[model samples]
Every structure is written in C-alpha cells, then in structure tokens.
Target: MTFNIHQDYSEDTGIRHSKYSETSGEDFYHDKLNEIFYGCYTRNEVLELVLDGGDDGYTPSFLDESIGNLVYDFTLDVVKTMLHIVSDWEPYWIDEIEKKTYPKWEERRRKGEQATITKSHGAWYRLINGVPEKRVWIVYTEEQ
Candidate 1:
C-alpha cells in the first residue's frame, strides 16, 4: 500500500510543511510507504520518522518487525521555505525578543509585532529583541 502525506504551505514565510497521517487506523509497514514528501521544515524529524523502529517516538520492536519499506521525496526548496516561515513565526523563549534585540525599535515593537514580513524574493525578514536584524531558523513539529 502507498502512503500519502499531507502538505501545508504558508505564504508569509514562503515555506511548505508536511505531515503524515494513518489512513486506515492501522500502523503502516515500512515497505508500504512508497512516496514520502517533505515541506520546508528540517529533515531531522522526518528522518527519525523514517527510521522510527529505533526512534523514541515509535516503538522499536513493533517498527523493526512490522514496518515494511520507507521512501522520501525530499525537497530542499520546501525545507528552505518552511524554515523561513518558522523563523518569523517564533523567535525564542523570551516574551519580546524584537524589543530586546533593538532598543531603537522598542517603541514600535511594543505595538503588537507582525508575525512575519516579506523583504524580497527568496528573502524573509523578522525582528528580534527590538533590533532590526535578519535571522533564519528551522522548525520541527516533533520538537514542540
């Protein structure tokens, strides 16, 4: 049986993300997964999923024995895009990173910050600690 993964794309960050859901309420065999795809998020989580037999999230004995085959349609562009969006969506643990980053923008940052802003083609921008600095971060759902 072929596995179908779900895809989600966000324009603000210009990245796509994917998640796989069981269709028949039954665990899929490793060999049954024929076409796996990834959006712009990091591959580490996905890689772990592919090798779930030994990963903490999935039981090793069940995966190693019952799992069949696994394949992936990895897309660098999608990964890049997802990272772009995620970086803008969440910066850090601090309450207001942008306000703290740039003192000059403190006044403006205090006024509800925008989740993301577009700078140009292939370029996404976000503020941190009130500073006007550019940064990129990768996001994985498993991490959350």
Candidate 2:
C-alpha cells in the first residue's frame, strides 16, 4: 500500500514540519524516501559520508546538517524508550533483592545514592531510576 508523507513549510515560523502516515510493513521504506526527498539525506548515505570522509576532504553541506538533526532526534527517542523500560523493571528487581538482602537499598536509592551509567556522549543515567540526569559535552582544542 502507498502512503502519503507531507512536508509543511510554515512561512511565518520558517520551519518545515513533517506529518507522517501510519503504514504497516512499508513504513521503513516510506520513512527513508521521506528523508531523502524532504530531509535531503538517507541514514545510510549520511553514515557512509561520515565514515568515508566525503570522498576526499570534509565539505559541509545542507544534507549534513539535516541528517545530523534527524539522527539526534532519533537517538534521543531511542534512549528515552530504553530508559523507560529500565525504569519499569526497577521496582521488580528492588522487591526481589529486598527479600534476600538489606531493605535499606531502596531507601538509599530514593535518596539519590544509586549508581549511574555513563555513556561516551557524556550522558548520565541513574541506575536505580533510569533517568537521564545529566548531559555534558566535551570540547576538544587543537594545540599548535
């Protein structure tokens, strides 16, 4: 089945907003086509450009910026869903552990004493609650 993906351009706000239609099995292909036509870059092409350094040297293009934003939004959603799943399982694990070990573990976790998971992106997640608590960007400087 064919689906329609609309890109609305707002003149007042100067923003392009995408409206997607729900499609069952062909959603992946549809989304890729939308990205290529509206966003001007496919995910695989963006990855290839980054890995191959753009066939020669680095040259900035509109496609690069567009794909970068799309990647960021997509990754943020994935991370949020993962955090939700982990958080949902926390109470079950805590209950199981309390039956065997000290009950004060939950109390300590409530007081924000839980361990954190750190990622290369400088994002930190609380292990007990699975909340994305902090994000820090590391800036690199080249020395002459």
List the global CA lDDT of all models: 0.23, 0.25
Give lDDT tens digits, candidate 2, residues 1-144.
Answer: 121112121111111111221221122222342233222222222211111211222112222222223223233222222211111322443233224222333334335442211111233222223222233322223320
Model 2 — which ten-residue stretch has the worst lDDT?
Answer: 9-18
lDDT of 2: 0.25
Query: Global CA lDDT of candidate 1, please?
Result: 0.23
Per-residue lDDT for 106 in model 2? 37
* Residue-by-residue lDDT tens digits, candidate 1, 1-144: 112111111111112111223221112321222112221122333321222121123222222212111101112222222212112222341123223323323323345432221221122223233222323322323433
Total clashing pairs in model 2:
0
**How far is 144's C-alpha from truth in model 2 (Å)?**
39
Number of the predicted model whose TM-score against the real structure is largest? 2
